[model samples]
Target: MRRRAIPLLVAAVALAAAALTAPAATADEGAAPAATATDAAAPAAGADDRHRPRLYTPAANPEAYSQALDLARAGLYRDAAGILAMVRTPQAVWFGDQSPAEVEREARQVVRDAAGATVVFSLYNVPGRDCSGYSGGGANTTAEYQAWIDAVARGIGRSEAIVILETDSLALIPSDCGQDDAQGTKTAARYAEVNYAIDRLEPLKGTKVYLDTGHAAWHGPASITPRLVKGGIAKATGFFTNVSNYQTDSANSWFGKLVSACVAYVGEGGDAAQCPHQSWPREQADAWIAANVRTPSYQWKHFVTDSSRNGQGPWVPPPGKYTDPQDWCNPPNRGLGARPTLNTGDPLHDARLWIKISGESDGLCLRGTPGPEDPERGMVDPKAGDWFREQALELVRLANPPILPGS
Candidate 1:
């Protein structure tokens, strides 16, 4: 979900939505939400892309389910509810960005209507989630962060939700986001809090959780292993690498391979002779395995990529004189990648998902304009749905995904 605070000048959409959305029910007896046709449309499995995994989502997030239903109705259900649990609207965010009381009331109603949905959640306000922009914003104190996580866990209650935990926390550990202020203590607490969140969310029988592994561009194989450890990767079912960001399948696949290799390398210890990245002697491979990759702590998950907005891959830099790729934040010409679902090829790459929706802009850049603005198109932001549609169709062709036997 987009996280920008809509200025109070309030677009008519916000006002109209607030004023006219169907009134939700009270705690005692809620109005049942209308269900979509049981037989929704879904693309036939790709001939070779048979690794179609499904992401179980809990109904705590009506918006996510609705989005999934939309995809199903459009014959894209295979890619819709495939990714685990997708977040609806976090109460903290609704309260902070739009309204407090309204969000509180609406949240309960949403939860009620989303009874069987399997949810995937994100805790955006961890103390040092993102170092700077695009994905920045977190609590100041660890205690506050914990309180926020506790609330989320409670909101999840017994629902079958897949939580994404916090994004970018690992990458930002050594960052200048005031982590050095209290030195190791603050850093340690960040992990502690994440661990706390995992423990709280995972106990529910239906919940399957994963922690964040920054994008392929952000952290190298060896670098991310220890970071994932600190972020409590051992405790979670697995860790997700690329979320709500763009990276070609080729690049993410290579990155995931290296990270998995490195995790194995480090777990065994830094014995270069044992772990070989190149064509090495059999002795070296065995040695590497002995020295690394042998952790009894946990067996992590296959990775997942955000096919969203990557129809045109990462924003390529122009010639030698690069003005801006516009890809760093949100570029206007972008579109939704793959809809969230569990069918990526690599056993390590779990899902090809729309981690970030296409039409939503990433707010303002370090400069002024919203990152997705396109001056040539006279499109200054992510409001119009055209860019998203164009990009989505382009990606569908680019992927040349094998359509099901019968659409």
Candidate 2:
């Protein structure tokens, strides 16, 4: 039997058709203008993942390693949509090497390369790019944030884009900054912010949104579920776990299962026999949920991932270090994992995306330039990411038969 399709019950959404490319495009699903960096609405923005050591993305196309994207398209079914970030604090500015023009060109190339398939993209520069502050952060007001979202909307509005919205905003948005640590106000406001975001985003067509639920360690079923509800999961596609950080796929699965259970339970009433809209009866509820708890089809088709640098899973904590080990910063021994793609099995899970690209280091590593001295490299490792690209190509090729160069 065919697996169930993820039904994105968005409260509000929006879509854009194509860049001046309407003439070159055909009907797929989404509507909007061609997504260009400039097209991406401003503020509204923001946005790791898991360890499978799976040789997936680059393995599909050896050519990406040796050929131009145009030439490599034949063999590679998909490619990654690396981090597309922006800042709106002092003013609007993008945060990647490729110029806005280059970013737009490559993004469109991805659209063309995929043929009719979907390309999963992550828009991570939401005002507060790094919730922790420091890099690519902003938007003190909701209106400012919405303006940013409008910009992102303009960027991908035109395609059948599967977007993973802010990674852990649902679990983090704080309400009042004035209070001396009022968790209640902070969480309450996050709910409102996310809900408003969904309303703004739903306007776009064919866009599947996944809210951020931090790595498994950060939350539990009861905790995340409430946040998800507040974030408007009822209207969203669903919530995504493990973005930017690292947890094994097995660990992520366990976490995902618990959250899914909570979602079912939340929607289910206590009196199973009298539960309204009861799809699975009380007796079968347990078994049914177990059987239906959305196992990620090996299809890995429905999801998107950042094969940017995960060849090796997260930084294993050194023997004794808990306080900012700096593993998140560009560390040694890291290789690229899966590339970004649009085939996620669960509709709620837009795509296993490379929201965080490797080229852009998280910050300084344990050994590298320790702070203050060299501020130029906030989190960029030009030399490091280049080496991983080769590894990425190898992995992508392994997953999909190597694409013959120039084919």
Candidate 3:
């Protein structure tokens, strides 16, 4: 069976041929001349009025924007506005497929575009990323990865950046996918590589680095806490969950708290096995935390959650479906989640981010069958990182909190 494909940097393409086309691009996604910053219309005028001062809107994809413009020319104003709403909003800028010098230049360009505002970078170039699965092709060796990190750090020198270090790096490793040796040499290198990244990037004057902890549904606190420790959460900002997966915000918050508490407990001479997990009854878990963890909230590690595509929550695949449901792979009918923000009320929760680009595809999902068509949708899905018009429309149409005001 194939592994899940997480979002990463890729050249955006125009929509594939299909009729009954969804929304067209807004002004931001239109054939507007390419620039350092986004030209798309925001919810309101001015940064302060539209959202917090921290949000950094990046440039939109020309091809996706042009497709939206065509829809608008045909009187698809509603659809065009919806597509515009997605690209204009502040989301992470992915960096992985570039050479070290190229990445440094691009990273520096983003910093200049932010203009003193905070920006999110989903850094996904860890060696053997996605277990050489759908989104493979990272650096060939650990040394190469270190050089890449060095360039990224230099690019962002003295600029505000929220670094979402390597998605699925800690959660999914070589050992988990049968890609490691008997002595687990590759797995050990993976840990060291993550630690090296933390050591290099965390020290930057204006950078805050968060490690990956997968999502709430996949790894509970007890299981992921130790991995976070092994991956160097002690010297980092914290961990991020639900990067390219759909899990409700409430669930992600609760899971984050459990992991934070477990990390504190283990740091203070407690065993990871005894820490409460997500599966424990709420009352029982609360009581356990009350009795054991005495660390102040501020001192404990903080976390962030991805709200980009959790608007409708996770899809429930039909019973007796395919042998492997592949629920995370472009599941049908998912909507956009909450908009990205820096003011999450919970101290332990850092921000609700659109870590995954909302409109991009999650690869050609096979669902463990021979045919190329996805049985559920009756169409072959787009390759990962491509502009998935059908899925993009579904997201806009079903977005939670409504992508447009008064919609």
Candidate that scores best on TM-score? 3
Tell me the lDDT of candidate 1.
0.48
How would you encode candidate 1's per-residue C-alpha lDDT over 1-407 as one tens digit per residue?
23332232123223322333232111111111231001011344233423322232222333333344445446553433221111221111111111324333443454455445433454466765556455455677778666666665556567655566676767667344654665577678777877887777678666666777778777665566777767766667666666656776666666665566666555556532333442345467546555566553235345555555565566654455335544555443443343344445456765554445433445443223343445423444333212233333333334312111111
Model 3 spans > 4 angstroms off: 1-52
Q: Compute the lDDT of residue 215 as modeled in candidate 2.
A: 66
Tens digits of per-residue lDDT, candidate 2, 54-126, equal 1111112222222223212332223221100100000111222343455556555554543333445554544
lDDT of 3 by residue, 203-223 (tens): 999899999999999998888
User: Which rank order by lDDT, best down to worst?
Assistant: 3, 1, 2
Question: Positional deviation of 58 in candidate 1, in angstroms?
Answer: 10
Over 4 Å off, model 2: 1-117, 125-129, 175-187, 269-308, 339-350, 366-407
Candidate 2's error at 342, in angstroms?
Answer: 4.3
- Which candidate's lDDT is highest? 3
